[model samples]
Target: MLRSVFLLTLCASVALCASEYRVKKASRASLNRLKRLINEKTEQQHSDEKKLIGVLDDSPLLVRDPTAQRHHDELAVNNLDEYFQGDVELSETQVEILEKEIVESAEDSKARRRRKVGKAPLYKRWDRTRPISYDFASSVPYSTRIKIRQAIQLWERKTCVRFQESGPNVDRLEFFDGGGCSSFVGRTGGTQGISISTPGCDVVGIISHEIGHALGIFHEQARPDQSSHITVNYRNIPIGRWNNFYPVSLSQADVFGLPYDAGSVMHYGAYGFATDPYTPTITTTDKNLQSTIGQRAGPSFLDFAAINIAYGCNQHCGYLPCRHNGYPNPNNCSECLCPDGFSGSICQYVQYTSCGAHIAVSQDSVSIYSPNHPYQFDSNSECVWLLEAPPGGKVFLEFEDVFQFGCEDTCDKSFVEVKTGPDFRVTGYRFCCSTRPTKRFQTLGNEMLVLFKGNRERSRGFKARVWSDVSPIFTTTSSTTTAATTTTTVSTTALTTVAVEESTTERLSVAVSHGVSGKEVAVKSVADAGNGSARESVSKRIANEKKNAHATSWFVLQERTF
Candidate 1:
């Protein structure tokens, strides 16, 4: 009698939970109607657009339209499916709650326009302190599973969010081979389902994008500040596709103080839902970024930064100092997660490249040019130049002579990026066309980073001159010489050992010597140390010595050479 009573109570609880998260499946008639509508829309799309989409279908880096694939998967998920905003699957209760919020926001539309940023509610965000559980269905393809793992690694590398295979956790994500790519936003009670179809939705960027939704991130274009950056063309949009361009209200999403990013992997392509393929449905305010909007080349630096902020990843190393808009790395608190063109332990150095340099700016203009300027540059190459001026001064740049690269509407193939703004984290102004820029550029701060990327269809690159507004009080060469001449004496009775390591193009040399009392042994090393293993070994040895030698005083100097 007791066993029967317990079973009845358990069954009642399960039935109540099911009603709260119930999804209404589509009927066969609804699926057939949606198929006919898709056929009609496909016939309207231009031939050139179809060809362009086909060429970029398999490319991971290039920007491409995935609307056709999305539509195809939509059928697989079944027509008349109760999908919210095209791809998100929400419970019946969730839909009502979101709808109520939308109606409330619409009532105060005028007030909402004054606000900026978009963020999910705090209650909906996952608890970052705990590991998020996930599992893959047995039916998921091996290749698709690999892509999903790669996507998960990228998120873990960039943020404090942790994920593990499903264990005893009741609230978890279960990945299965559905007809479309879709997921519920944030964490819901019990096991939530995420669909990742094979052949169509297996790209790393696409997988990352879907995982982003599960992490509570909405589409980038849905931000409240989107209107300031992009213009949506409703006339070019097909019927029933206007919902894809709807912007989320400020009350629904938070921007976390990040500016609008056109290159976010979550952004839709220019012709995403366009009936007239020649016209873009979404156009960037900065016309140069037209091709950048729909990029699926992994997450942008801002995307990772935003996630880190959302998950409170920076709190892990609040005591550490990072420069140039960088934050402390969650995985390694000793180091910083830098922007695209910056590196070093604290993001104080420009990312080193074989063809670039660290240039000191003076009142006299210094000429800077791409590698093999006036000649076709090598394919698949990247270079970065750091231009610095004295304190309280700004660097000025002017383009001169020839300027050419692989030209695209959005400068996707090859481009020269100049970062002149005060914030180094955002995407910089890019130039790839053959024509030289008519106007000069000036940095808001004392430093500026210029990057050049070359693709297979290379051409003669650009030439530019840079100078400082204020003359330096002292030359860098003089300052270095003065510091080098200074000396310190150490009074040690015991013999002191010193080791020096240096590498040239031909060989690596290590020298160890002993010094007598009252004499100090100063060791210096220099090299174009492109190889990482040598540095790693040196670091490991220094760390081991520091850990083992408790009584002895040890001084270690490490330098990065480019």
Candidate 2:
């Protein structure tokens, strides 16, 4: 008895949940009115499922006159029975709702008569949960299934809504072989049918187009503002087919402020509904673009933007710092897919720039400031500074009071470059957008190039001082008997560039007994550099050189060739 009572309670719970999602029934009067207008005589007499099928198979006259019956071929794919309102398939509930809206529009039509009469959109949408569910029929081949999955992925990548496989008990899309390729606009409550007729509907683009309709988007040409951009030649259309070109009201069509896009994936081709195959039916404002319209390649950028706007995908990002560099991904709003050379959680990092001023610095010391020094720097600029030290010296650079640019590791946006040589051929130390300034950069070579560049644009570039400082001279005189007591002096120097005060250190002199190549040469310290301020400068500079001693090599040695 207890078990029986539990089963009964569970059944009740399921029924309650089902009722929440059930499609609301239209009033008998409203349904009857729509049936008369559309000429679906058996609509009220049939079952719900039968009624839907009947609507799909019927096509009523939309105009007073139509082409001759001899010319109207029933086998044509573009026949009026293909869809209602050109390609949209409306449910009974939708038709009733549309009737009510039509009544309201007629009452307001007089007031709005003086306003613009451009076509508007139909506003009815799906009653779907956040992510829509879909499943395939057992007869769907693996190859076809792959294509359909790809279509779903394409939409998922662009829009906030997601599509996932559904279980047996849930409302979902069921793909099956039908008379033709088609899908109902938005959701139709329970398990909906999306025809994937083989041979004709096997293309990737076609699959995406059908899925777009199921996602609640209408055709691009059916947009309310289409009249402003293209000419729909009704003369080329058949009499009863005029409903195919019916304009939707602005209230029904939620365009989300996007412009008319003729190249949308949801658009039909130029010959969409041509009464005669040779005559064009849809013409664009610019005749040259006629061929470019009605592309079924994939969703355009605007299409993605509109879907994102509809689902508030970007808004889901909350306080994330994605600005000019990136748009938040709909799937994962916290993460972002940044443009090339940009990275980080919010796409704040810039890699490098190719524009600026070129500066060659060969002086003992020079101060380099951004273009328009104190003011903001120019956009798309490349500036280079070449610093040459004394014959045996290195270049010392330090940041001044101001330094700023778009921050990144490679400094792609705005940055300061300090290189080993006076050109960009080699790698260098690059500094970009950051609150902490760079203290110093001392090059091993006598010549160094400092490049400054800005990618797009930003404020107060950067100010830096470059000074050429000589390492404490270490003179080594080696006498060789073969060359009449020839003397060679070897000097080892260190890099001493600082952001603070200017000072130097003492030099170290060493005595060396030279030997033949590949043999070890003995060396001994001979004397300390001179004392006092002069010696202190040399000593300080020498100390700086020691700090980088581990990094020293033959590259730091200065010598003369005989």
Candidate 3:
């Protein structure tokens, strides 16, 4: 597809003869505007080139009523839907512009200096700690699994392994070999691992740690009492520095000395992993575990001791008691604790989709805040941030990509307006990655685009609203407030109609006054239906234009069907 579809909005005054895009929803309203746009631009081009003076110009360089063209517009730009699996190629100049924007955006998004400070840890070392793997969906690190498999092999040299009655629960774990590594175990648990793709170093420690978990070792960060885990007190940090920078919220397990193993494999260098709002950034003191963190690439003595007690190795034992609920409940959590569109403790309720009770659609400027941010994923995730904004209201979707103000990149997004029920539907969206060396829009989650229309399908009971967020692709653990500025004003629903005469030569405007996008066969025009305000504006404008055009009383032969 021609990237000009995007660059044209920037470089040219008229859209191409036609273009291919991503959204699939057939918006009768948006199509109307688009059709007019096509006509206005094309007619100007034809008239300029066919500059025939007067009498000879009877060849009639023409711009006529849109009535007949509404059906034609149906097959125009908006109806062309094809799979977007390949390169949505952009021009060389567009690529340079995009790459430059990405670098600049990164610089601007790096938090304030004060926020960046204290990111390093003062003094810390990995404390050998054993952990239990109650991985619900098997949330094990790739490296951790390697070590577990290796240990099973080592342990099985004498006998077949039986970690689980059903084969070992290894999913997508990674492995790491202990080289001249300076990795040390930490006192708590938050996600931590080396980039190594081997089982010896990266995965070894985790396997031992998870075994510790099977044997029933809780994470060090879950210290029962805040006073026991560390001399310095702070919250948990997941990524970067400053993790655990705030006061940590204690879980039930943390309050009870589940078991303390200084050399257990479960320990991370810093205790920021399990905390909320995550210690904003990485800490300065945070360091990796030394190569000898586990003493011999295995769990510490305490690890074996605890496992022996929790579940007898040869006994096929039952697990030690778990104090907290084993599963996550997305609803019980605060907005800060949840992912973009997820809420509750486990984040099962999708606030943006029908998974939630109702959804509101609105339009606003979407751009990248940081180059490091996966724009597509970030945009897709920015939804939950607005979950409670318009708790109960309709939506008005707009299409514009400007990266001024706080944003860093000009977003190349699309919209697909759906009409599932009366006022229930979603505008689809799919965000692209940096349009750079690799010119591909990286898709993240399900968010598509924003759309607004009344309950055209089922106008009575439930209103299931939907939309998409296609922007860029980093899935960060921060920046959830990018959509607070978005505003969706509900419109007035007065149904006033107006008409115009065909004698007018100026561009006549129409008021699709209510949420409506359709062609006016009587006046070769199409209008977009939307939130009451926009529709009203379109309707009133059309009405006034009709009045002025008819002041000369010319018969409009093409007034009723397009």
Q: Say which candidate scores most in lDDT.
A: 1
TM-score: model 3 vs. ground truth: 0.20
Off by over 4 Å in 1: 1-86, 106-123, 362-370, 373-376, 396-414, 430-440, 455-562
Q: Flag clash pairs in model 1.
A: 118-253, 118-254, 118-255, 119-253, 119-254
Cα displacement (Å) at residue 234, model 1? 1.9
- Cα deviation of 16, candidate 1, in Å: 23
lDDT of 3 by residue, 1-562 (tens): 2443343233222212111211122243443333344334323433643221111212111111122111110011111211000001122332343234323432222121111001112111121122221111122344555445676543322211233322121211111222212211221222112122232234454344433332224443323232232322222322222222221122111212123332244433221222432121111111111111112234433343333222223233233321111121112112222222333333333333311112212222222121112222122212111211122333232223321111111111211122111111111121112111111121122222222111111111111222333211222111111122111121212211222221121212211111111211132232222234534544554455344322112212122222
Q: What is the lDDT of residue 487 in candidate 1?
A: 18
Summing lDDT over every window of 10 consecutive residues in candidate 1, give the lowest-scoring window.
474-483
What lDDT, from 0 to 1, does candidate 2 have? 0.49
What are the per-model C-alpha RMSD values against the true structure?
12.4, 22.7, 32.4
Instruction: Report how far off residue 508 is in candidate 3 (Å).
Output: 99
Q: RMSD to the native, candidate 2?
A: 22.7
Model 3: residues with Cα > 4 Å off, grouped in runs: 1-148, 153-161, 164-196, 199-203, 210-216, 233-259, 270-296, 312-562
Q: Best candidate per TM-score, number? A: 1
Ranking, lDDT, top scorer first: 1, 2, 3
Poorest 10 consecutive residues of model 2 by lDDT?
498-507
- Displacement of residue 158 (Cα, Å) in model 3 is 13
Instruction: For each candidate, give its TM-score against the true structure.
Output: 0.67, 0.46, 0.20
